[model samples]
Target: MQIRVADKAIDLSEGATCASVLAEGLSKKQFKNTVAAKCGETIFDLDRLIPAGCDELVPVFADTPEGLDVIRHSAAHIMAEAVKTLFPEAQVTIGPAIENGFYYDFAYKRPFTPEDLEAIEAEMERIVGRDHSFTCRLVSKDEALSLFKDMGEEYKLEIINDLGQDNYSLYSQGNFTDLCRGPHIPRTGMLKAVKLLSVAGAYWRGDEKNPMLQRIYGTAFANPKDLKTYLHRIEEAKKRDHRRLGTQLDLFSFSEEAGPGMVIWHPKGMLVRTILEDFERKEHLKRGYQIVQGPLILKRELWERSGHYENYRENMYFTEIDEQAYGIKPMNCLSHMLIYRSNIRSYRDLPQRYFELGMVHRHEKSGVLHGLSRVRAFTQDDAHIICRPDQLLEEITGVIQFVKDVAGLFGFDFELELSTRPEKSIGSDDDWERATTALTDALESVGLPYEINAGDGAFYGPKIDIKLRDALDRKWQCATVQCDFTLPERFDLHYIGQDGERHRPVMLHRVILGSVERFLGILIEHTGGAFPTWLAPTQVRILTVTDAQNDFAEACHKTLQGVGLRVEADTRNEKLGYKVREAQVEKIPYMLVIGDKEVADNVVNVRLRTGENLGTKTIDEVVDMIRNDCLEPFKRGGMSYSFF
Candidate 1:
């Protein structure tokens, strides 16, 4: 057989393994760093035999993303082996590599504790030290079932039965064997840097009704340096956890009495939300969007007509009112459609952009409910545009630009992903194709790069998802623009064209900040709770150095508030240092120190949150400085704002 590695071709026997081929073809260093090999699009384990009719072998290096995934997967298998060795009664179900890590689920007698995790880590280290090579074998379904059945792995048995395949691949290292289609590293000794992070209870396959299993989360890297960097990021993420910051900053709370996934916004938190909503309203109005409102619940028939009943009902909340079934909306597009249908639009009005800070509800499982990011009830900065077919591309491009502007305003850099149709989606294949193409065309037109996220679009149409990168370099899905031809067709929406005939219009479902709650959560972490002045719930705090300066502090607060600044005065009988520290802890942008010098001079001493003193400034100068700081972001985003 003829095969190629890099630019060289060689004749080899049919049963040559990838490892032997690489050892012959690649340099010593390249062979040492190679964890696996890629034949065309398919990755193969080093021990796996090279398939016939294949010609090229591309090395998968240890530091590459794919190679890391292979490493993590191998680590998961090794971890599973350690668990089985340490706890013979444990029944392993499945383990898979995820982004940045891997996890294994085990049906055990009880939940694993932290102490157990330590022991398991030790066992895994011992297993790695033994340097056992991983080998694969093929078995028929019945034989696989019988083998696992004899081993008393009920989970494996169930998996094998459900697989419904004539043959299955089994990977084994040392005494541990698992059903896996794998391209694992050659040996357990390849796992040099691994850490078990946490243990949590997970349902067998994420179904709440299934038997719960203990899931161990761990991550592996090519070496210890990368592992240390990842661990540092993990620690930083913990410090910036939104839930902890929410409580510390008096932002929002979740209460069991109020039911799960419901955000109870405290005064400060609500103020921040209001600021965001108000800004959204102003921006949309400036961009030719008409602000609109929709009811909290619509009749079930409306949802049915929109295909939500058939495709999205599982995630929707439904109720009955006056013998009529209603669905509390999980999306804002339906009502926006109704609004567009209420008017008879002409081609002259090619696009009608309707904006709403609409509150939506989705039935999120209790286990998936997160702080503010994933909640049952949240508001979306939703807008739907009804445009003639000819205007579709331009409208999509405009929305993408709007997203870029908004992200820039928040000091965010984002990447775009074009999501295609899902299996349960509405619309014809041609419509889906056109919609997907339009999104891609818009991205290309603007010279913006995006990835294709297949089978992850809305049921009605394909979409462009904008994921914002935060300060910690974490990505958050906050913006999206979805193109929908199905909804307009389903609702019979039309606009009079130049030909004086009714023509079907295209609809766009979009959100700049997907869920206000989720965006705020991301913003909190992104800013580390140090919000910019314009968006901060409290922009400034006037601190009285002494009781004698209390009156002046109140005057300064009034002056700031008169200029539309969110200001507060700290006049308690506390030390000045304590007040400053408290204000800084609250993440306020500016702290005005009102002491005898400032009170006598009719000026305020300015202290920034970063501990920089700006000398003494008159009330007018202070106001101007604060306003400039507030408008700086708008300028960066190519927008104008006024503080007066």
Candidate 2:
């Protein structure tokens, strides 16, 4: 048999495996780090025999990202072995590698506690020390069922029977065996840098109807330094959890009486939401977008026509309205399309952009809902652009620039992804290709690097998704620009072309700050509740040292408010240190320390929440300092500070 490794052809024995070929071609150091092999687009175990006439083989090393994923997946299996060793009654069902880590699901009588996790981790270390080889074998379905049945693994047996395949792959190490589609590491000894993160209860296969199973989440890295860095980031993430910060900052709350996914916006939280909404409206107007609003519910027939009832019915909330069925909208596109069709448009009026901070509803499952990130009801900074086909790439470019500018406003770095057409999409093949090419061209035009997400686009169109990196270097999905060819066709949308003939228009759906509520949650954690002076719900606090300085503090507060600053007077009957401590806890950006000296000098003593003391300054100087902070990102781009 002939095969290719790194574009070099070599002849091997008919039954020779990829491992054997690599051993002949690669240096010992290179072969030592290799964990898997890829033939074209398919990845297989290194021990798998090379197919006849196989071309273009590549090695997957442990030091690479994909290699780390493979290591983590095998680590998950090793963790399963450790669990089964310590608690022999546990039955493993499925385990797979995900982003940054892996998890295994098992059927157990009770939840695994912290102590159980510790013991299981110790057993995993012992197993790794044994350095057993992970040998794979192909077995018949009946054999797999019987093997699991004999071991009392009802979950595994059920999974094998449900598969209904003639053969299944079983990977075994020492005395432990698991059914998996694996390209695992060669040996248990390769899993040196592994950590068990947490154990949570998940329904079998994520279906609540199925029995609950225990899931252990863990992560693995190629080296100890990387593992240490990851652990340090985890600790930082814990300290910056939005839920805890939301309460400590008195921003938002989730009430037991109000529902799990519903958010109760306190005064401070409402202020933050209002500022963000106003900013979005101003930004849309700056970009020549017409603001529009749509009803919360639309007739079910309209939803069915838009393919929502078919492709998205599960996430929608339906209600009967006087013998007619209507669904609460999960997206704002359908309404925007209706607005475009409300009147006739020509090529001169083709690029009609509609903007709305529209509220949407989705029936999110209880388990997936977190503090504001996933919610049953939330508002999107949504917009739609209707333009001629020639203007498609330009419109997409405009959206990409909009996302870049907004991400810059919050000091966030972002990565872009082009999501291609999915298997069950609604558009024609030509339309899908055109839409995808337009998105790809726009990304290239902007000269930003992006990866493709195959079969992960919206049913109506291809999209460019922007994932933002926060202060903790965690990614949050907050912006997307989708180029739709199906919706306009389905809705029969058309405009008069240059030749005065009716032609179909391309529609674009986009959101800069994807969801208003969710974006606020991210901002809270990103800034740790200490937002910039401009976006701070309360920009400044006037803290008086004693009753003697009360009059000066009140006058100072009034002056600050007169100049358009969101200033508050902390005139509580308390000591100066106490007031400062409280302000620090609330994460207020600037504190005006009003003392006898300040009153006598008729100047403000400023102290930053970050512990920087800016000595006394005149009223005009203080105002200029704050006004500059208020217009930071906008100032850089020559954007108007008119909204503030």
Candidate 3:
């Protein structure tokens, strides 16, 4: 038979295996890294016979993202094999590949310690050295269940029963058998450069009621170079850990006494957050947005009307007051809708943008809560654009431009994706289609290539999610521009048009920084807590050499403060080096070191936190230098963007 391989037609024998194709067409060194192939999006093992209906075949190389996942998945099976070999009574439950690695869960005698991980890893290396071929077999559900039951694997039987399938596939290596749907690597010799990372306790199937199992985490790669690079990044990520930096820098903290996910901001942390809030306010004002405030709690009836009761009740907080139930807002849109309906709006009053740094509450799962990234109470740099149908495209375009502008200030490169309406969303087909088209057209007009994310939009509308890649190349979902037509229709929002008819206005819900708290957290890690001058809590710290220069340092501090810079003074009776070291530890942008010589010359020596020194300069020059290092955010086309 004839088969097309990447646009090249070749004569393939009947019932030919992937092993034959690679052996015949590629060198031995090349085939050593060939794990699997995909015949039209369906992955197949190299040893499996090519399906009869396959007209085209694409080889999946080990270096690609898809191929890396395959290697990791096989690595997971290898780990399970090692565990079972070492502990004959241990039953393996489930193992799967995750981002950057794989993990296997097992019903073990006890939680795995560091020594157990080392032993398992050594056994895995031995198994890989044996080079046992992985073989797959199809079996009936009854046969698989009986096999697992006889092996005393309750977890496997439960999973099999839950699947409710008549037939299942199983993979085997050496003497170990596992229930799996796999297109794994053909042989174990290909499994090289694998390492076990750590071990943790996980509830079986993520249910607390189920028995807790030991999960061993590990990772693999196509080559040693890639694995080395990944391991290096892990070390770097530890140093940049925001939780550690948050405590070390005295930024923010969480307490068991207050709550699990609530943030307790210290005085210095509050100053940092205040600057970000002020910037948000000024940006909104310049872009034709009116700053609006909404109540924290509203009647349950209002939530029902806004569809939050049906779709988002699980994540919301509710309370009762005076025999009436009230829901603490999980979203700021409901009150913003009421604002639009407060008074009659004409076409002249169209395209109203209401901006808010609204604080919202959500009942997040305790297990999933992180330091600041995942929190119960956080403020959103949120706004809603209510515009006429004709104005929807322009409004969305402006939002995209706004995101680009904001991301540029921090050197973030973003990728765009148009997220469609979700399965549980509220809206008519027509409303959804129109809203989706508006977003798509806006993206096309700007000439940006975007991927389509199916069914990942807001509950009320489709959106353009901007995933920004930080300095470490990790993507964070920051800015989102959503087209929400459902809210206007559900709320019966209307505006008097030129035709003297009541027309429904379209709503665009968007945010430039997403959650302010989350953004700050990312910022902390991205820059390693050394914030730029403009956003730094202390832009300049004036340090005097001793008591002799205290008055001069006070004068310099006053001058800097008068110039609208966030400055402070350290006039303690300490050595110059100690004060400078303290200022550096604080990550202050500029340190003005005043000494007897500098004070006599009417100048202050500028020392950077990075340890670079500038010769003595007048107070005005230092102030000018600090301001120059500050960020000046602006819109595209050289247009100045306002900030508070």
Assess every candidate by TM-score: 0.97, 0.96, 0.94
* Candidate 2 deviant stretches above 4 angstroms: 1-15
What are the candidates' C-alpha RMSDs?
Answer: 1.6, 1.8, 2.3
Per-residue lDDT of model 3, residues 349-421, tens digit only: 9899999999999988665578889999999988999999899878999999888878887778999999998
The lDDT values for all models are: 0.91, 0.89, 0.87
Worst 10 residues of 1 by lDDT: 635-644
Q: How high a TM-score does candidate 2 get?
A: 0.96
lDDT of 1 by residue, 1-644 (tens): 67898877867876798888888889999999999999888999998788766788889999999999999999999999999999999999999999899999999989999999999999999999999998999999998999999999999988888879999999999999999999899999989999999999988887778988999999999999999999999999998899999999999999999999999999999999988888889889989999999999999999999999999899999999999999999988888888888889889986999999999999987766789989999999999999987888899999999999989999999999999999888889999988888888888999988898989999999999999999878888989999998999999999998899999999999999999999999999988899999989999899887899978887788888987899988889898899999988889999888889889999988999888999999989998898999999999778887656
User: Cα lDDT for residue 316, model 1?
Assistant: 96
Model 2 lDDT vs. the true structure?
0.89
Over all chains combined, what TM-score does candidate 1 have? 0.97
Query: Residues 1-644, candidate 2, lDDT per residue (tens digit)?
Result: 46677656777876888898887767799889899888777777888888555766688888898798889989999999999999999999899998889999988889999999999999999999999999999999989989999999998887888889999999999899999889899889988699999999888877777888999999999888989999998988887788999899888899879988888999988988888888888889989899999999999999999999999999999999899999999999999999999999999997999999999999887767889899998999999999998998888999988888888888899999999988877879999999998998889999999999999999899999999999988899999999998999999999988898999999999999998989988988888778877788888999988888888888888888998899999888898899999998888888999888898899988998988999999888888888888887787766666633
Q: Which stretches of candidate 3 lie over 4 Å from their true place?
A: 22-30, 87-91, 107-109, 205-212, 632-644
